[model samples]
Each structure stands twice: as structure tokens, then as C-alpha cells.
Target chain A: MITLRQLQCFAAVAECLHFRRAAERINISQPALSAQISQLEESLGVLLLERTRRRVLLTPIGRDLAERANDILKSVSDLEEFAHGARTPLSGTLRLGVLRTLGPYLLPHFLPEMRRRHPDLKLYLREDPDDRLLDELTSGQLDLILMASAPRNDDHLTVVPLFREPLWAVLPLGHRLAAKDSLAQADLAGESLILLEFGDGLREPVLALCHAAGSREHADFRATSLDSLRQMVATGLGATCLPALYVDAEALADEQIVVRPFDAPAPARSIDLVWRRTSARSPEFRLFAELVASHLPTVVTPL
Target chain B: MITLRQLQCFAAVAECLHFRRAAERINISQPALSAQISQLEESLGVLLLERTRRRVLLTPIGRDLAERANDILKSVSDLEEFAHGARTPLSGTLRLGVLRTLGPYLLPHFLPEMRRRHPDLKLYLREDPDDRLLDELTSGQLDLILMASAPRNDDHLTVVPLFREPLWAVLPLGHRLAAKDSLAQADLAGESLILLEFGDGLREPVLALCHAAGSREHADFRATSLDSLRQMVATGLGATCLPALYVDAEALADEQIVVRPFDAPAPARSIDLVWRRTSARSPEFRLFAELVASHLPTVVTPL
Candidate 1:
């Protein structure tokens, strides 16, 4: 049988992929970490790492077990968190993973409600793309993930529908298209559309609508953030699409930008609150999701 | 800050959801297990399990951590397996996950080769759906998975394409369609197709082709395995589609069954060997995949 201490040592080495660095990360001496790894290998009757004069590398099995070891370690931490949450019930720290596109625009609306409802709770937020959010959630780095729709890979997680927010066509205030009462797909024909760089969850959907509208992506420029895109469009750089929530929360303040909805049926992103299926705080998370949904501006339709 | 013993205790209880049964599983006394769990909760400052007078239930966090504990335990075992395999390459036990549709036919051809090449190697085979195989692979329950195509949720896994096996139309001897040199999509019009029940990865592809051919699935009776489907077709029950490799491996001796390919641009299933991204056995598994590809009959095209 393998011990947790051995696994912890193995995981630290696997992550850093270097014994000395891994030892440093765990605040253990290099020789101590090295000994633990060697002992682990001897007990398991297999060589997990390849040690040379200058470098260390995991054997194939070492690589395989490294991930499992991380998962295991994360689980141990999660068990502690579960117990803590149950005893205090939202009194401790809650790590939340948010998408960059939604973070700045949405957090302001819900944080107040959360603080008021659970005054003892401490909220820590990290923003990234959908993929990174899901990855962190799986590794127990984040207690819950708030993102656009539930991810396709929800095999081990539960996703609660929060709300649906429609998209808007963003243009320079003085642009001819901006004068239109409502934007039509045909209005974008032969135009070059601006969009955020790759890895933004909004990229695909916007590109699809761009293609459907006979417009092509702006090959030269990709904005790093929604604010950058709005700035570029304000200067007539190119037209782009943004979710309605962003416009309501952030864009309206910029008088140089014009935002409009497409005809009756617009492409909208469904926001969801997702957490591990086995999380001990299902009821709490569910309740939080409901509270967040209720707090969302009426412009954003709650699911 | 939790110890391995505490995790072991929590995991056993989570698995059985009963203190007594969990203790029995771990060869510890019920009171000991209970004490460990309580200590774990106290140390973590959270509650993991909700114990009622009548039953044991995992709190949401308990369920979540249970999965992590299982992964942790599996990782430890994997470390040993990894070490053992490294000391005597391919000599120790290799747990392989195979799809139900492909296993019976595919294994016979390669098992002998595996034995001849690595005499001391012990192969432990498991047959399951593609999703489950991938899930187990992620959780460290399986070292390698042989299945059709790469799974969609393979961000953390490595998939090496092995071969492409075209599908075959199965018919009873003397059936009107058997006389044709080759089958066509229209030939299947109005026919009732027999398919393995849901979760068999092959079902979706077959159903798509069936729908394209103006045919419908046999709703009344669903066969559990390819052999059963072959038997049904052989008895003049109904016609079905199968991968060419299956026919070569299992149906060659069945005189009552007639198998034929499509006219052109036939639909084929790509077989691949999948393993965790962190697995150290890439070179070895890749070599095995190549060996299996080479051993595959001419009917299956090696990648």
C-alpha cells in the first residue's frame, strides 16, 4: 500500500517535474524529498522517476500516476473543505472561478447580495476561459465555476441554469449601421468583423454569426478584452458582437459605442453555475445559484 | 493537514456509506473507523458524512471527496504497477480497457503476440462503453483503453490512431441483397436495422447511416452484443451493419452470414489506443498499438 505522504512527495515532483524545485515548493529538504520518492519506488516495486546527474523525468507510469496523485491530494483538501463548509455553512472562504468576459460585468451585481446573505463568507475569485475554469474545478482549486452555459464535459459535475443573456451588435456611434433601429444578419454582409483573441468562449459563436452574415473575421487585429474591443469599435476599427450583460453593465458608459440587438431571435449565451457533482455543499451551492439568478438584472432573463 | 489514515477511513465509509461495512472493507473495527472519521471532521473543521439512526449518506462534499479518495487510492496502486513494469518492461500486470463490440474479436489476434513478446506480462482486460473507459482512464482505474476514434473529452488524455476498419452490411444467406456485388445506401431503404443498445459507441454512427439510408432501428428487440446481432441476422431475423474487423475475427466461420462492403467511400470506424496524458508508457503503448495494427487483417487498414 502507498502512503499519502509518498503520494504528496510524488505529486510535488510531478508538478514541478524537478526534485529540488518540488522539495522547495513543499518546504522540505531536497534529500528528504528524494528519499521519500526512492522509498515510494522501492515499496511499489517500480521506478516512477528517471534521475540523472542534471535532470529528473517521470517514467511512463510516473506520468500516469502523477495526475491521479494530484487528484487524490486535491480530494483530501476537498474533504477538509467539505467538513469546514458543513460546520460553518458559508462562513469560510469560497473560491469561485469566473470567465473573463463575464467577470468584470457580472460580479458587481451579485457580490453585494452574497455578502449581505452570508456575512461570514469570504469570496475569492479567479477569471479565465471556460477550459481553464473547468480544469481548476476538477482539480479542486475552485469550489464553483460561473461560465457561459454548462461545459460539454459535465460528466462529474452538476450545472445549474442561472440566466440567458442575448448578444448585441457593437459599432462606432457615428457608423451608418449604428443608425439602424435593429441590426439584421444581412447588414453584416461583406464586412470585416472584429473579435476577441482565441480562447475567449465568445469567439466561436461570434465567428459563426459572422460567417452566416457573409462577413469575414478581421484578420489583422484581435482584442485582448471586451473593453479593448469596445474601444477599437468606438474608433471605427471594426464591428463586433458582445453579450447584452456587458453592454448594460459596462458599454453604456462609453458614448462613442452603439449597441443594438438583432431581430426578435438573437443569439444568446446561457449562464450557468457549475460545481462538482459530489460536492458536500450541493444545497448551499444550489441556493447560492438561485440567489445569484434572482439578483441578475431583469434585462438578463433568469432560466 | 489530514493524514493518509484519515483519508483511508473516510474513503472506506464513503464507499460502503456505512461505518460497519466500511470498517469491514478496510479490516478495521467499526468504532475505529467512526473515530477516524470524527477526528478527520474535527481536524478539517467540516462535516463529511451525515449519519442518521437508520442509514449513512454522504454530504455533497462527501460525494465529491469520495471520488477523489478513489482516485488517490488508484494512483498509489498505479505507482506500484508503474515501478513493477519499469523494472521488467511489460512483465507485470497491465490493466487494459476495451470496448464490448471490439474486444471478443480483436483480443484473440493480439493476446498470443503479447504472450510471445513478453512472457511474464499479465494482461487484465475490462470491457465497457467508450465513456466509461475514458472516465476510468482519467481516474487511474485503467492504464490503457482501446476504442473507436478519439473521445471528445480527451483534453487530458493521449489518443493514438491505430487502424481504420470499414463497416460491412450483414445479411442472411440467400437474402435478395446478398447477390449484389456491393451494397448502397438506397439498398437499406425501408429496412429495420439491428444495433447494440445505447452506450456502445457504435450505436450513434450506425443510427446516422440508418437514418441516411431511409431505414429505421428495430425498436422491439435490442441485442446486447455483436454476436447476438450476428446470430439474429443469420437466422433471417433482420439485417445489420458491423465493422469489417469484426467479420474477419468472428464471422468467418459462420456460413449463414454474408458480409459485403458499400459501393464507394464506405463508412469506417477509426480504432485508437488511448491513455492518460501523464502516462509514462507512451513508447511501449505506441509499440503495442503498432503491433496490433500490423496483426490486423487486410480488411482493416493500419494507420
Candidate 2:
């Protein structure tokens, strides 16, 4: 029988494609790691890795087995987490994935609250783009994900709405619409807008808003972060839409950029806490979601 | 002839795994996109996608082909960029990949300078982890990458040293060493340090620093961003190391956190501008690198 340790060693080697590096990654001696790999190969009656003087490459079957091994390891990890969750509510480590746009702004407030309330709970955070966050969450690498737009109609996952964050329009200080107390979509007609690139969850909503307002995305420019968008706006490239939480945390103090609210019925996006439905920690996650809702700043409406 | 359009359609389908969504992503009708996929499959004599009423899946061969198609598309993009670069330096869209830890702090200062110097240049930025940045740079999806500790002895790439950034020690306001004028490696012995999780370029250096100082990493917690690290330190989780640019930009004003420089021969990392050696824009990138070095604040020493 192939032990979990064997699979773990193979997975590490498959990922790094270097025996020495993989050995170091797992904190084992190179010869010991090599022995495990050799034993596993002999048991399976197939060669897994082709070793040259300077390079290591996986066989086709090896690649397929490595993926299966990762899945098995993830399942084992989930089982361990389940056992741990049975004994404690929020005391142990919880791997949380958060969106890049939200992590910087929300975590500063949320983490402190978590530290204050659950001192024993140790959170391991990973900030990534929305799709990658979702991928990691589904793969069991992350216990929970906090994102603006939750996945729709996925039976394997549970999403809890945490808040509704308004979208604010950001413009250069000397722009024509900057003097308005509150701007409507119509006011943006024919204006150029700078937006984040595709794959960002915020981009689609901003594109929809631009389409409704007759504004065009600056054909040649797409910012990678909220800071870049603000900088572009500051440099008079074009206006852009930012979430209320981000505006409050990062943009309100920028003298060159003017942030304005929308007219009645402001545009907003739902913030959610998502986890696997099969997770044993569902109850604790739901409770933690409430804590998150309570700790959010007043700029966003908690659900 | 198998057209680029067919490959684009197939790549989109492979990425989204849903025909309707893929078609929408590429801004084409579903039937039109399907026809393109069919044409490509017929020409190649292989089944690329297995489409059912509820889901779209890729065959094993489809997965391999999709990756190759992407590489071809990237090469085409590079050719177009080469032509554009030859026409006018820094006038067209330049896809730049930057490190997540650096972009937020540095771009606010850098973008405005770029705008002032080259009004026609449209910069498309993607801020990701170091590995992803390097992957994109080598894959031709990005014109350049700004990162620290660039890869060594890679003949396929060009590395331009930009600056050296000092690392600072961050502690909670009332911590034992908070009142000290400056800190040294000896002062950090036996301290519990919170560091960013692995895959971040900064983590390894901080871990080495911890090793040299006899400090140990906080095993139970790992932060995802510099902000999270700051928050963790603010809440007295433990001390952490932060780059000088980040300290100058974000952490200087936090009353609860004390940012102190290291004693003589402070720990530091090298920041470099990296791109593929085959890129036709090498001259332009070198000039842009110089501009970046010049715009960086006094907190970091430009190489």
C-alpha cells in the first residue's frame, strides 16, 4: 500500500521537478526522498520520473498519478480538519482565501476583531484574484474565501452574504462632474472610463455600468489594482468606479482625485463568505460570517 | 488553413469550459464560436471538446492543444508589440507585471511620472505573486516585470537592477524592543516573527533573516499581504519584517505599530526589471527601467 507520505513526496517532486528542491521542501534528505520514490515506482511497476543529469521530467502516467495523489492528499487534509473542528470551534488554524481588492481594506479591520474575539484562532490568509481564490477553496487548499461576487448555483459550496458594498465614482479633481454633489449614470455619458482588466470580478460590473452610462472603457489601459486605477485617475487618464470600502480605506485622502456617491439606488456588489458544503466546520464558518458582518465598517451595509 | 480565430475560440472554450460563457468572453455568438471549434477539431483530426447539454469538458489531447494554442497567440502578440515598439518607443500599450507587495506602494509614485514623461504610453499592469509574474514574463504575455531577487543565470531573460530596498523591523507599540533606537540581528533572537506565506518573494529573505538572528517563524499564522502583516503585528501577534517602500508608504502613520530600521548593514533585497532577451523592446525597457529607478522615493537606494 502506498502511504500518504509517499504520495506527499511524489507530489512535491512533481511540483518542483527537482529532487533536491523537493527534498528540501519536505525537510527530508535527498537520498531518503529518492528511496521513497523508487519504492513507490517498484510497487506500481512503472517508472514515474525520468532523471537526467540536470533535469527531472514526469512521465505521462506520472503526471496523471500526481494529480490523483494531490486530490487524495486534499481529502486526507479535509478529514484531519474535520476531526479538529469536532473538538474546537475556532481555535485551530483556518486557511482563508480573500480577494486582493477586499483583503487590503477589509482585513485591517476584520483581523483585529478576530484577534480580539478569538485569540486562539490562527488564520492563514491567501489573497488572490477571484477565480484563483475559488479554485483554491474548491481544491481544499483554503477553508474559506471572502469575495465580492460569490459563485452562482454551485451545489458543492455554501455562500453566506456578509455585506452589500456601494460603488463610488472616482474622477480627477478638475473634471467637469467633480463638482456635483451626487452624480447619476447619465452624467457619465460620453466620458472615458478606466477599468481593471478582465478576470477581475470588479471589471464586469464596471463594464456594465459604463455601458449603461454611455461611457467607454479607455481602449488602451486597464489597471491591475485599485491603487493603479486611482493613480490613472489622478493623472487625468479617466474616471473609474471603486467599491465603497476601498474608497474609504485608500482613496478618500487623495487630493488629486474626487470620489462621489451615485444618485439614489446606488450600484453595489454583494460580499460573501464561501466554504465547501461538505466541510465539517460549516457551523463555525456561519458564526464567523456573522462576526465579519458585525465588524465591517459603516460604509458597507451588513447583511 | 487553420486560422488564428479558430484557435482563439478553442482557447476560450478550454478556459471557460462553457460554450455560452466562452462565446460571450470572446464577444461572439455561441453558434459562431462552435463553428470555429469544429473547424479546428476537424483540421487537427482530434476531438478537442466533449460538449454535453449541461457541461463542457476538454479531452486529454484538448488540454495539451489549448496550452500550445495559447503559446502561439502569445508569440503573435509579441510580434505585434515588436512592430509597435519599433514605430514609437513607449507609445502603445505595454503589459507590465509587478509584484503584489510592490505595486500598491510604488505605482502611486511611478504612474504619474510615466504619464508626465510619455503621454501616449498606455500601461496595462498585472500585479501577482513573484512566480506568476515570472511565468507571465517568460510566456510573452507581459512586456516586462518589476520584481525582487530575479532569476539567476537564465540566458533567455534580461535583468536590469533597479534599486536595493532595506527591510525594517515592525513591532507592536508597547513591545519590549519598541523603544530601541535601532534593531540588530542579535536583538531579534528568540522572538516570534510573523512572515508572509511561501511563494511570496519576500518570505525567503525574511526566513533567512530569522534563521540568522535565531528568531523563529510564527508557525500557526502566515499573512497574505503586507497589510495583513501590519495588522497582525499591530494586534501583537508578533513582530515582522517589511520593505522600506512599504514602510514609507503605509506603515509610517500607524500609532499602534512601531517601524524601526535595522542596525548597520541592514538586511535588504535587490529589485530588478526583467524581460525576455528576445523582446524587441529591450532598448525601450532599459530606458523605462531608468525612469523607474529615478522616480523611486529616497526610502530605497536606486542601484
- Residue B7 local lDDT, model 2: 73
Q: Each model's TM-score?
A: 0.41, 0.38
- Give the number of the best model, judged by TM-score: 1
- What is residue B190's positional error in candidate 2, in angstroms? 0.6
lDDT tens per residue, model 1, A1-303: 677788899999987878889999999999999999988888877667755455566665576577777777777676566556546566556689998999888888988988998987777899998888889887667878898867757567899888888778898877778888888877888788898876556887788888788998999998999989999998989889998879998887888888888886676778889987767677788888878887888667788
The CAPRI category of model 1 is incorrect
Model 1 alpha-carbon drift over 4 Å, by segment: A1-88, B1-35, B38-45, B48-303
Worst-scoring 10-residue span by lDDT in model 2 chain B? B77-86
Interface RMSD of each: 9.8, 20.1
Runs in model 2 with CA error above 4 Å?
A1-303, B1-86
Q: Could you tell me the TM-score of chain A in candidate 2?
A: 0.71
TM-score of chain B of each: 0.69, 0.72
